[model samples]
Target: MRKIIFLSLILIGLGVLLSFRPDRKPLSFPSSRVLPASKKDLQYKTHSVKQSVVHTLLIPASSRFLVTPTLSPELSSLESFVQKHQAIAAINGGFFDPENRKSTSYVMLQGVWVADPKDNKRLMNNLKLRPYLKKILNRTEFRRYRCGQTVRYDITLHSEPSPTGCQLLDALGGGPRVLPELTSVQEGFVDFAKGKVIRDPLGSSQPNARSAIGITSDGSLLVVMVAQKPEAPSNSGLSLPALADFMKTQGVEKAMNLDGGSSSCFYYKGKTVYGKINQQGNQVRRELFSVLVIR
Candidate 1:
């Protein structure tokens, strides 16, 4: 009888001990050969264009790019955007009205329209007149097609209307195509396209901190941010044409310029990788409306 009672107490004590133990996350074992850390694969380099400085980042093909929209209407800095999304790297995305701090271009998050046109008239007026845009804009069937699972890095430029342009915005839902810049490759480089290197028409000589996105020959996405050093002279950023030339050297077949100048920002691994100095003699870290985050 004593033995039976002792065994029951022992069993109850064991059960109580097991219940008090803390939960643990499953351990991940490396398969066969251990792989190198992902951070080791990311290449960081600095290049000089005359007096200006260019900071380039080469991300491997395995990485994924996502467009993170503002959860609130208020503008937030690049650091806040990265933390909110838990991104490995990020750059400012598409244009936004400074007053309202909302994306001026169409933005879709996870197959849902975060920003869309209200009335048909507004939708029709926002339609891009270029041939490529007209086809998708005029067709009612293609208006609501899902272009991709996430937002594309490229923007549909209402500034320079072209028939052969990104239909991503329309695919999400009808919205304005008014962006200052579009795919730079499609815009064409007179010097580079002609197998020569001359200053581009878009003021390649005027140096300013720049931000751009591109696709490599092997289909890897490239996000670039160029900024002037805080202590460097005022003449310390890449010209648009110089930026294009640099992109060509990087094997980028297609590319686009994002908001540059004071808006240029690059965040990587929980830190601001690159940022420009503003005219106010302060390092610029302006609040962003949207950002392209890497996961």
Candidate 2:
């Protein structure tokens, strides 16, 4: 039954690919342009956000959320780190649903990685949303950082149930391959998740009070950043549209939304990106049960 569903999704994806015509072509930017350094050189200065229904974006009106990265100025030093951890060579990011558990602050790190499938088993062994430094030190690839995908989309996955418990996918890749786990968990698809080749349509989600993250195959990064509508409205320092627009501006070919809210956050380049914001504001807490860090 799962095989049947998987096949259907591949066909859908193929159809979408075949039906492709760029709505807008993005202006080219140097793909090699590196991000700003973390400056601190090693450790990350932590920040926080009060858990809330709606989350926010990195740069107001920015699609590209920057990570102050872990670095080794010397290749030998970098190689030493890579030897201990996993690593990937493409751009990716987004939120992840728990392996089987669900919650309000459930958004965890998820994205593409460069590692072995056996590593997947190891990662699942310690899968906790928002894991800590020591906890994250597992599955090191060549001593650097393990580069397995935050969200594992193997052939074994099945239907993604809606919030009300209805399966969206009727079929998937047919044989042993798994679908990408494409789902809205539907309140419905938001804006950022939509495609805009040139950033005009720069898709951003409709600002969910809660959300998570995930990555696709198109070399794009998604930040399922969310901001909850409070029981009583107050200053929520986060924003969107600009982030989605920034993503487009950054030349991401495709993007989308995920589960987030207080759960939204990322770790890369040695520094944590925007910290979690729940109801109040930035709240610094470590090890969120489950977090997908890019090694």
Report clashes for each candidate as comma-separated counts: 3, 99
The lDDT of each candidate is 0.56, 0.30
61-96 per-residue lDDT for model 1 (tens digits) = 555444334333587888887787788778876555
| Predicted structure with the largest lDDT when compared to the true one | 1
Q: After superposition, how far is residue 51 of candidate 1 from its true place, in Å?
A: 2.6
Candidate 2, residue 185: lDDT: 22
Error in Å for residue 75 of model 1: 0.9
Query: Model 2: number of clashes?
Result: 99
Model 1 misplacement above 4 A:
1-40, 63-72, 116-205, 231-233
Would you estimate the TM-scores of all the predictions? 0.58, 0.30
TM-score of 1: 0.58
Candidate 2, poorest ten consecutive residues by summed lDDT: 170-179
